[model samples]
Target: MVGFNGKSNSAKQIIHRMRRGPTLPDGGVNFECHCVSHLVASPCGYEFREAIKCQKAASEGELEEGACADELMNFMRCAIRTECFRSW
Candidate 1:
């Protein structure tokens, strides 16, 4: 009686909720390059995501190359600027 009993929440409603954007809070939209958790919020997020996908594809032989080098460099730069990362 406390949870979905199939009456209050229909299957369609559940599916719609699941179809929403990234699982991360704030709609997963990071607006800065703070380098939190090794990922830049803005452009780096997209680049890093693609790089990871490419790496996976390479490991699986689905691609002739591995992760993106350009994005990796950008990530390094961002990491250096981050205060907690200790760029020294």
Candidate 2:
């Protein structure tokens, strides 16, 4: 996503940084160095990682199947909103 400065940051950098350390309450790791502008434009990457965790748990019978759909929908909705509203 493009930062407030209008420079694009690599999705790979964002995703990799998010996955590099311990998980947060949202189930994805947070990085201190991430651009706040990027985070504001796209919150779904974190949510999507969380939903993937939920889906995996459901698939393993650790969580109810019904719960997975809701989380998945949340991920999708956030993704669409982020893409649609992105500054560039």
Q: For this target, which candidate reaches the highest TM-score against the unseen true structure?
A: 2
Candidate 2: the clashing residue pairs are none
Give TM per candidate.
0.32, 0.39
For candidate 2, what's the RMSD?
Answer: 10.9
Candidate 1 colliding pairs? none
Q: Candidate 2 on 36-88: residue-level lDDT in tens?
A: 33443356757666676666456555455376777778877887876745566
Model 2 residue 29 CA deviation (Å) reads 12
C-alpha root-mean-square deviation, each candidate: 9.2, 10.9
Q: What is the lDDT of residue 87 in candidate 2?
A: 62
Off by over 4 Å in 1: 1-47, 59-67
lDDT per residue as tens, model 1, 1-88: 1235645666677766555543335435332323333453443555566554444435444444534566567666655554335546
